[model samples]
Target: MTDWAAHEGRCLIHLLPDVITLFHEYVQRNPSDPESGGILLGTVHGPHNQVVHATPPFPTDRRTRCSFDRGSEGHTEVADQFWRESSGIIRYIGEWHTHPEDYPSPSGIDLREWKISAAKRTDGRPVIGLIVGRKAIYIQSTSATGKALVYQALLGNCPALGH
Candidate 1:
């Protein structure tokens, strides 16, 4: 796992190797695509949020030169299965998508979507948002308390931090 401190060290974000691998493969497979993304799943422990799993882009996902719309087709079923298999340990935590820029930053749409997702959280916990860019990957966590912290990506055994 890779750890990142946010909110001036108030929150810790951990990215698992598996999730990183998934993102790598997805990006490699669609090297020329403008955007691609899916769901993020994991568990939360106190001030630490661990992301351990991620879904591949759905077949029905809408992709464009600048945006990615995660399709819902079969998503609920997959999330339910993951929750059940983990014995309620893992749950839907956030969303991740790709950007064509070297250092991608969230757009207005991204911020709005994150706020909506945070507001609907049943556990009142923050929802993570990730953007995989050509050079670096950006991560953010937003909570019900209106705190949104951007995390610094920590690459663990991954070829490069900004790959």
Candidate 2:
């Protein structure tokens, strides 16, 4: 597991082992490989949010050397399936995509997309934006109230962290 705390320390985001693997598997390793990404599925409880699942890139998604546009085809179906299986405990908590750079950061398009996602949430929970680079992963969360928190982790042997 990998852990990150909100800016104020009021919230914590846990990306489980499986989710981390998924992110790592899609790294833009090859110079020609376009970016890839999918929606994050997880469970939220108070200030602790656990990311348990992540959808893989679908053929429907649009990909370029520097950008990824998640299509609707398989993402929603997977989210729905997980929601039903988990009795609504699992859900779409955020989005993640790959960047060709070694250390990735959110682009202007990413921030705008996150803002739109946060606004669509009726439950007021935060929306997560993750960018997986060749050597690191960036995580940012925007609360329903418009507050934001961010973190980044370097990848190696996938060391587990937190209690």
Candidate 3:
């Protein structure tokens, strides 16, 4: 498990070990492996959030060495199902993709997409953007008002992150 904090500790994202393992499974380690990603599903608790599940890439998703475009099919249905099963507790919180670099950073396209997503949210909750790299993960949060912030991991000792 890892805790990521942003906005002067006003917001926190707790990534469960399972979620981390799921992401690590697609780290883009092979030269022929394309980028893979999916939707982030989690539960919100006041100012804190716990990421419990991540949808896997589907056949319809567009995957390239440097980019991943999530397909519409299978993604929404999974989110809906989780929402119903959890009594509206679990929801679509964010998106995540794998990067080839060891220390990944958000690209211009990524930032733009996140901003657009945040603008479309009607619940006033933040939208998260996650990039899993070969050795580290990058996370960003955008508020309903378009305020963006980067989160830092509380534990600087994760083996996968090479900390």
| Cα lDDT tens digits for candidate 1, 75-95 | 667788989999999999999
lDDT of candidate model 1 versus the reference = 0.79
Q: Estimate each model's TM-score.
A: 0.88, 0.89, 0.93
Residue range 1-163, candidate 3, lDDT tens digits: 7889877888889998888988878888889989999989998998788889998899899999999998879889999999999999999999999888999999999988888888887787879999998998898987766678898887673437433
Could you give me the TM-score of model 3 versus the true structure? 0.93
Q: Which ranges of candidate 1 are over 4 A from the true structure?
A: 28-31, 154-163
**Arranged by TM-score, best first:** 3, 2, 1
Score residue 83 of candidate 1 by CA lDDT: 98
Task: Tell me the spans in candidate 3 whose CA falls farther than 4 Å from its real position.
Answer: 156-163
Decoy 2 TM-score against native: 0.89
Clashes of each: 0, 0, 0
How much is the lDDT of residue 10 in candidate 3?
88
**Clash pairs detected, candidate 2:** none
Relative to the unseen true structure, what is the C-alpha lDDT of residue 93 in candidate 1, on a scale of 0 to 100?
Answer: 91
User: How far out, in Å, is residue 97 in model 2?
Assistant: 0.3
Per-residue lDDT of 36 in model 1 = 81
For candidate 3, give the lDDT.
0.87
**Better candidate number, 1 or 2, judged by TM-score:** 2
